[model samples]
Target: MKRILLFSLLLPLSVSSQSNDKMCETLSKINALVKENHFQPKPVDDSLSVFVFDKFIDGLDENRNIFTKSEYEKLSKHRLLIDNYIAKNDCSFMNDFVSIYKKALERKKSVLEKLETVSLDYNSQDSVKFSKDQFPFDLTENDFDRVWKKRLRFDILEDISKLSKNADSLQLHFTEIEKTIKQRVFDTNLCKVNSILNNKNGVKSILKNDFLNAFCYYFDPHSNYFSFDAKSSFLSGLSTSNLSLGIEVSMNERDEIVIEEIVPGGPAARNSKIEVGDVVTKVSNTKGEEYWVSCSSMETIGEMIFSDHNKQIELTLRKKNGTTIAVLLKKKVMKATANAVYSFIAEKDAKVGYIKIPNFYADFDERSPKGCADDVAKEIAKLKKDNISGLVIDLQNNGGGSMAEAIKLAGMFVNAGPISVLVDNNHNQNIINDFFRGEIYDGPIVILMNGYSASASEFFAAALQDYNRAVIVGSTSLGKASMQTIMPLEENNENDFVKLTIEKFYRISGESHQIKGIIPDVFAPVLFDSLIKRENSFKTALPYNAITTSTKYNPLPKNITSEIINLSKTRIDNDLRFKELKSINEEINFTYNKPRNPVRLTFTDVFKEVHDIDSLWEKVKNATEKENSLLIYNTSYDTKKLASDDFQREINTFKLKDIKSNPYLEEAINIINDYKKFKQ
Candidate 1:
């Protein structure tokens, strides 16, 4: 995962006051540390410099829409000089690049401002194509302006189509969308100017951070630099002192800052005024002085709202229904229970237990006393008391945390045995084993996983699968099996740290789940499989390797795996819900992967396209709901008493809905039931 940097509300104190001496001092320290402690250190040669140069440029202009070809050529002189510059602690190349970028931004801003005043015919047969790969930079000013105009037009057309269905209404919505586009562009430009280009200190810091990160990532994808603000946020997340309004925010494709999830018991959840998909337009202080926080990164928003605990902040949000509202929330210590282990009994032919492990969260600080391993153990004990014949541990979307917790958690299902092997760069192997003498439940266990299940989660699932203690089901897990250790540069300063990948993990079966994650024994239809993000997708990711281990574990009964797979295939073939899920997955894959031809600029064409897309998603939702109905399970919680607290009531309602609608959980329960029958 990318490290998020928290920003301060304070503007840059001095725009051109960065000292070369300070820059050199910081660079010297980083270079020395990288050489000494980096897992796979590389020599600071010309080849390394070229890699760093390209990475830095990509970080600056990711879309390749800024600096022209001529500008790039001008900076090519420093492509092979980065090593020398680093050795000498010089930043002359960075200064030159920043100067060129600022000028290009100014020119683009001027073009956007002028274009916003003119009206273009929406009936024309004009269209634009978008791609992730970098394109040739426009050589002439006219070419640059043309590229931006087409992009702006495409954005406006897309937004208008979403708002209006007919030609007449499209025109009205287009006008409104044009105004919004102009304002957003202007606001973004101003922010860049003030925070980056205009501020020498900010520019210097960014250049240093980017350059160091490029150097680190040249070794592998996981190792990178952490700025002061970023390090602070990372630490805070691991500790109980982390304070927030309790909302997960993400930037949508339309550049809108959307509320993705509301943390239970958080201020937003307590207020019940915000919903997922709400676009946050503005943020205000207690005095009602508002700032344009729309379309900003989550880190920037976190910095603005999380400055003080118990302080009130107001947000102006636009909902999916096109209604706008103001919500005031007091920032406080978010409840730890939000990430705690949660379980419920799924009653079918026989009672079965289901536990959802969000992550292997554990506080490294011994005094914290809160750990996921203990929580999961307790949940397992409770489920055993309920006399569940089978158990399903859902590890979906679990991007993993502590390795210690993973080993301990695996111990709950099996007696003492080797769980995994840790291989360091020196070719030394350390076997991580389970010391527990007794199993907690020892019943039929099914471990549910997805593409997002990574690191520690993979370790736990792989261990259980190795021991034949649990049947791994769902999509292949996220291929992230490397361990990272945070190494602080300055002994006295906690703000400067580098997360370096120090070791790789291999299962007791002698296979490393590095780039090739654990493959499920039974596969199900997963929507957005192509869109699922994973570490192996990166070109710079470390290659998968395996080391021989002497440890051995008990395997499943002969023919059991084949029997269960055959049974699952037969059941899924006749299952209407599974058929619908497959259909939904195919539609989604087709829609997203379809070719992008020239779209007629006419309102009718755009409206039809938008409507078709919306209809396809509606079918997917309906199919999902139908699948969820099969998993409906009864709960014993007293909702009437919980209804007194709005947040708790909402949480209970969500839990009930999830239990009813979870198709994956339902399948796991069915599989466990099959295993029970086989044992009989």
Candidate 2:
């Protein structure tokens, strides 16, 4: 039967009018392109079919809130048939899946509505597990009712915990507060359902896109299918500046859009009322079109804010103290440096220069090109002027950007040589060499990285590590080494695009750190290392492989490296704050990795759970921010450069304080100090 099904899958699909023609064509095109050009493409067989089927379902009902066990079982029959369906260019299966999911959403909505009138028992000893992984899906509609009611009660209890932290200040009775909280929860859930479905046409469109994305994921995590608009957005986000409010937002557990970070020197950073953790309640575009965030999809709100069509926007933010304020913001050209490199001189035993590259952004404006590589070079020049003995390049949390920029940055450290090797799908090798002849700053150097450092960051780090130039510190880096290029499906049109993985790169040492990331020379425990989902975590990630590659470059003497690493480790062990940080990381690892117990629904028990989690992180925050022995200062060159801009100056002020308090930076400084001593 399996052999017969495989033979049938190879046949040309019969076009069905019931299915979307564009979607069918897209899947077919993506299928052909991946098989032809992807770094490593898996055959469309039962294995691929099962992966896509499970992923699509998981994407829709991640928390197991929508689909019941019975519904899932009914859908599981199609698990092995996705390969056949895709091969035939048929999207009818998507329609069925969406229909079932739609019905499940409606059922959930009905339960939410029923929950509003029903009073929950606050003192009940019943326990509910918060994570979906900790429990199973409901067996029936009756089971859904019991599960959803518990979920509603849990949400209400959490809200009450937050609202009544200062019960005396609220001055509201418990009964009235409970009623208000219940109504709010019901309204939010209803809005989430309405926004997802939108109307008759929207449900199909949203699910169709989800299906397409899931189909693409089976090839590799880097390979993705993108609509014209999404493709444009993806390209623009790669080291490009956009006109915006300069604030980043993320959805919290309650589905509320909370401000995550305000970009330094951006419009939002200047607003005193707008703060991180402030909930965005509403947004209005330049056309005076208002969108209630609770009733709208985050994508819609994000488009309104980040889209070039809107030159101005007004955001209604709800503060922690329950006060609401609306701030009008005009679009400004936020430079790449707003989130790029910032240099400081750490004065401990010596003047150690510090430079952090959060991303390797490129100059999108060809006419006036000022890329991350150039920015780092400028900072290095300033640090050189400060007469620093050694330098620490912090690449922690850098998810990477332009490959060209990464190569250029690597050039600043080493002499002209073949820095990296890229192998295409056909096994054609291409050597990426740095053409620049001389080094900018060749002093004793330490590069700090964590699991979040990926792609171009890994490329740069790998080059330096292989050359034996920079001592790599911190945890293992994110192991992505593949390169992707965007291609339009149709000629002379910008309708559909696929960002396909074209090549996988290898370090100059001929080692390919694809799934397993770059292991640091000196082991330093990063506080959030375990929480990071590395490349190996992905089920379909490309396997690690190597090629015979040769590159000639002079390396720093390797004789004293072991001694330096040992000294740094001894310092970390002896330091009181460092010991505390290590202990906190262990506790964090346990808390995050351990099987969670069922949470008690009562306010007291819920509050305790909330407090314990918060306290665990609070300890980490305090340890990292503890006053260190290093005296950090901005360079004169940077001071003069920022003298003309008040916004940049203010940002620099905050960064200086942050750098002084960073334990990791302190440790990296110590390592560099050791390197300098060993070199002497």
Candidate 3:
């Protein structure tokens, strides 16, 4: 898997700033490298300059709260000059931009501090509608005052609604609780402003990175620039480490820190309350020091979790159901396999082996030569020995890694053919084939995917679909077929790095699933497709294209393919849970996509609104909980291994619990059975 740079918080904050000359030198190098090596690099002209300028400004003030309309107008003078600046290796425009942005930050800091000391009128009829697109920049100083108060009032009202929901359980005094919630809102906002102003290297360091990363990001969403310390911290996540809560997180488009995955065999896996896609709103330690994620940067949040000082902590996570839950957890020593692939058997009408690959993780460390493909091969062998009639490989939420491992894993199912095609920057194509000569366990196979199954995952799934090697299931895969690799800024110097999109992957049919992604043969009610960002969600994402290739291969018989699909569709259409899930998906779409109107700040009004949304999500939360769960169990070999360790067994039990109730997996089992029946 791609290494997460969790240790960035450990880097020293009190560091000397780079000179403008130094910054320009770095930018020049980056510009040259990207243009030369990027898969489809755009020219460094007016278009690129404008993109970088707008992106930099947006990154600095995403909420459009900091910069006034006039200030923004003043800054737009250098919009078209950025390309010229880069061509001349000049830092004058950036220097001017930073000087102006700093002033804006100082002004914003003052406004926040002033707002904190006073109690705002929560009873006001005025309301605030949050929309990234609809929200306008402050037109004047008076507008700033109005907007800030609305923002603060909205925050307080939200918390009040949350606290009052449990008033009966807590026997809360409304007036006192309101005061406490107001103080929290004030403290959180002020803290956010102060942290940025107090940055030791100044805002220049942060903005400089943003400015440079704009070019890299515009090339493709995956490309990035890393400073020396940043590079080290990012690469550090490749190794197995301890003192982890056993979860991985990502900042969503809304700037909410969302739990992306729960590491198996980790503390989080054991907790029934913790789950994927929960938004972490607040974090606190046993010492009663609490930090709100809304107010803190991701780096700050990382320090709070990974720091040696805080071992016991409580995370206040906001579930999609519009409810908040506090999960008390402690850091534990976890093993490398906490993130590894594991398998189980789902028994219904037939015995089907289910293998869950968290990601296409290759052993980056020399000491551990076992890659995901090798582990998968071993799992298949065990399942074959157990006499499984069919197999299900789960790639749900797998954000893919190691292209080499994906090729190897895909090879295990397909009998010798061109698995995929790779296209380089210069328009040269190379066919990536499964030359393994024979299949491992090719008895009817099903691959499960969701919106988060990206990169190498899409590659593997697309190949199987192309050759009719496996039946693809679930909603849709994350449409990202491009490959990226890191290169040093200076030759042989590992300190400064830039991850660039080097090539794109195509199916043996020559269709590139860039932003289009892979459409499953059978569509189930998509559980995780809500706010599940995909390639098309990214503005800079590459477009889908197809090429004419001469490679020939035969697919599974048309009659069999159509028969299996029809059988599965008939079963899904009649299932109550599946119908409920589909209804839930539609409601979720309406709730998120319909233009949000200004929500009245009154407790009664806000409470009703929150309740409606919460109820909808409650349905979503329990939609897949089958009254009659599938019979899921570990294989004999895994059961024997788990028998030796209680912790491993506990984790195994949790995995089975998920497998038992999963509607997607249940349907996959049904499909596999359908395939087996058709064959007979």
Candidate 4:
């Protein structure tokens, strides 16, 4: 029935006036393209042709450029519905596709206009309303975790009406839940008044925060509504994405930046008497005096931290025992130290150099010195330094970044030529450059990708694969081949705005990164397959990877197929940890088996478990008391020692080590050691 409907729709597309055979031939060609290229097609005679065409338009906008010119010409010819667009009475698929698409656009004209208003006053900071109410958000420093929850709740977006059934119901339900939240806050607020506490500051603090967050709720996740104070702060926070002194800090009773996470081999990683929990009470310039920089009363502190570029800051610290100390450190722009790991792995393979490109962000301006280009060049220098081996670019989890970066990065591997092709519904094509001037790492290359690799990562990997520079390994990458555009909510808050899918990218070979992300040449599952975080929003994320045919280059393998396979098998067999992990994961899968109805164990089962637990605890406690006579005494009740010989004699019988603390992490280390040969 569906096929008959399609055929009938095709009949109307060309009309019986001309040759019916000619119309059928056109339909057949279009079908072949759709089938061969993995292109998803809308139903014939459906309004979807226009939607696809408009979607193509959106993708080519400032933020989304992926298709090539040749692709556009082919698709444009395929767009004909009933009228002549390019040549009158041509009756080609492109003309018909365009006509149908234009009609669809006319119908959706209002919806497009409605989208324009999405940037206006969305979740503006001006709308933040504060009250004495703190219902679900009453917290001391000890309740720091609770603060995060409240802040996240207030961050919910509204204002833009969802497209009916296309909205998240859970999000809408939370909108309604705000009423009850306020009532509870009101109850708590009243109780506070009875205590005669000076909570005006606290109330004002919360109100201000709500106003700012609610404003950002109007835009995409990355868009943020910031206060004048926060504008200075966002700039500094962005520095973290680039490069900075490898330091992670937190505030204390006396507020400061306390270093926490340190990347190994980084300048600040360990070259210090400083410890993790030391507080950065104050930071000063080269002058020895402490500067009165304030992180107080502000939601963000990075503003002050990065305000002074290429300068030294004297950091005064309050130690854990309340001792004061100071440390002066110079700032250095840090590079992601991921390359060394790969280089080490490829050291043994005299024929393989490794490059793990997480994302492509090239700060290609006089403003910044280090970027994807600089980093890649440095790594290439290293690979070349070794004087041996092919190259393997590990792009496992890289989502994507700038097109310029992707293009430039792709150029590093391949010699000059066309990289990828972009095709729009109008059959327009654009050629992406593949410039390679010198120092091409022309060796047997392999690109390691997985379901998580996407976007610019896909572009880099696909370009390499298209150019025959690398063989893709692992499963199909995440198909997010589409592009997006960012439009700000207000000129005042440049950071806050709408990020929408704008365009689709096609490989030079004409493959969309959409649903079918880059398929791996070799399907080897990663070692930590059981640990992938799947309960995420990614399942609903828009198409960023789509597929099309090659625009220019065609790559073939160097016949290392059996070698890679042999290596994989040897590692799997020898690595006991991999085997154990595989076994354990299989058990976990069974534990989470989906069922039509959830299991409801009877009351008897609950009784059995509780009785067993109680018995087990009692037995353990008894054994502990006997083994450690003094240490296993009382948890809540403290025993008073008598000023007598008997008490002293009793205390002497205890051993401290007999009673153990929770040893899960240690147990894990031991387990790994058992399989250290190939698994750890």
RMSD, every candidate, angstroms: 6.6, 6.3, 6.4, 22.7
lDDT of 3: 0.80
Candidate 4: C-alpha lDDT: 0.44
Q: Taking the tens digit of each residue's C-alpha lDDT, what string does model 1 give over 165-261?
A: 4657656666677677556655655565455555544566667677778878887788877766643453354333366787776555344668866
lDDT against the true structure, per candidate, is: 0.73, 0.79, 0.80, 0.44
Tell me the RMSD of model 3 versus the true structure: 6.4
Instruction: Please name the candidate that would achieve the greatest TM-score relative to the true structure.
Output: 3
**Candidate 2, residue 135: CA error in Å?**
4.4
Q: How accurate is candidate 2 locally (lDDT)?
A: 0.79
- Which clashing pairs does model 1 show? 15-200, 628-661
User: Considering summed lDDT, which 10 consecutive residues are worst modelled in model 4?
Assistant: 628-637
lDDT of 3 by residue, 461-556 (tens): 887888787888888778999999889999987767899999988888888889888999988888648677888988888888998887777766
Report the lDDT of model 1 for residue 116.
65
Q: So what's the TM-score on candidate 2? A: 0.86
Model 4 residue 45 lDDT score = 32
Question: For residue 148, what is the lDDT in candidate 2?
Answer: 81
Which regions of candidate 3 fall more than 4 Å away from where they truly are? 1-18, 166-172, 228-240, 253-256, 288-290, 293-303, 336-339, 528-530
